[model samples]
Target: MARTSRAPRADAARNRDKLLAAAAKVFGERGLDAPLEEVARRAEVSIGTLYNHFPARRDLIDAIFPVRLAALEQVADAALAEADPWKGFVLFVEGLFALQARDRGLNDVLARRYPASPELSGACHRGFVHLVEIIERARGAGLREDFEAQDMAPLMWAMSQVIRETADVAPDAWRRFLAFHLDGLRAGAAGPLPAGPLTEEQARGRPGEPAGSPGR
Candidate 1:
């Protein structure tokens, strides 16, 4: 027998969730231009159903991109609540890497559009701040090397870049690379190029036009 869904309102919510799930898969494969009709088909709904939930392209993109950003906050909250800061930090890295792996296009899309949505960027910044606290506590406990709070953002961004690119490879391969960075470079806070702590003017994502070009 088919499993019964909830009341009418709850069933509507389930349909919304199904559409989003289908959209995530479709968008992950094709990026922002994934066909909404295919998404509706995958969700076993009509095109009208898809529009009923998300009427515009930006709305659909918002559903896919920023939702993961919000999920980052929840992961940060969970990890920070754990007993060991170092353990928490590891969880944070793994969670972030997993997010990128789910949709390889996500990093590129976010790198460009992160600045457009204050809420998405702010959530990421908050998550990084939470990680900074963890890093400081872990260093204070002598479990990790020293890193200034400002250094955290760039370092995290760099590591995120590495992980995003290396994602979908063998899991251990990425872990080994991360371990090298953590043990040799990041663990010591020593680098040829110094990055001061985050400033009031600087934001989380790297906001710049494409190389040698105006207006992308």
Candidate 2:
């Protein structure tokens, strides 16, 4: 009886593993909004089985993305370790965009598409702390004094759009955009602006949200 009971548990574990693998592949290719049904089909399991393992989409996202997003922390660490602050900052920004360009689901995560996942939110928060440090260091070196950590959100959003639009037709198009922007961030290139940068809370909120909207 004990051995028979163990067999079902083993099968369930296998199904769970298959679901995770399928979800990762489907989500990576199609973004986080990819249907759970496709993940189930790719896993060769019933939709019920997928739901059995991950009751909701956020549950699956929580499982798959936190581990992947952990790499962002490592990238930040590498940036911080670099001797040149400006180079370090560039490394962090370029590394971030490159990762997003490679994975559509990750791009959505960076854009805060699913605000309900605790794991993803925590990961993003931790990454933000590192970004603050990187920006401060770069400012001390040669970055524009007016540039704030909050400014990166709009810059990243624009880059995300560029990557999405030109991925097939011009895979390296974002590089040109990034270079132009990086130059503008230089202290020598600084100039008066019509408006100030967003507050951290405003930056975290959806685009066009009122300045007072609660951040996700």
Best by TM-score: 2
lDDT of 1 by residue, 1-216 (tens): 235544766778999999988988886765455567888999999999888888865566666666566666777787789787767776776676566556644654544433345655554565455766666766644343545555545554665566555555653456666676566434445545454456745634465644432111
Cα lDDT of candidate 2 equals 0.84
lDDT of 2 by residue, 39-133 (tens): 99999999999988988888888898888888788889989999999999999999999988888788777876556466677878786679989
Local distance difference test, per candidate? 0.62, 0.84
Report the backbone clash tally of model 1: 2
Off by over 4 Å in 2: 208-216
For candidate 2, list the clashing residue pairs, or say none. Answer: none
Q: Compared to the true structure, candidate 1 yields what TM-score?
A: 0.63
Best by lDDT: 2
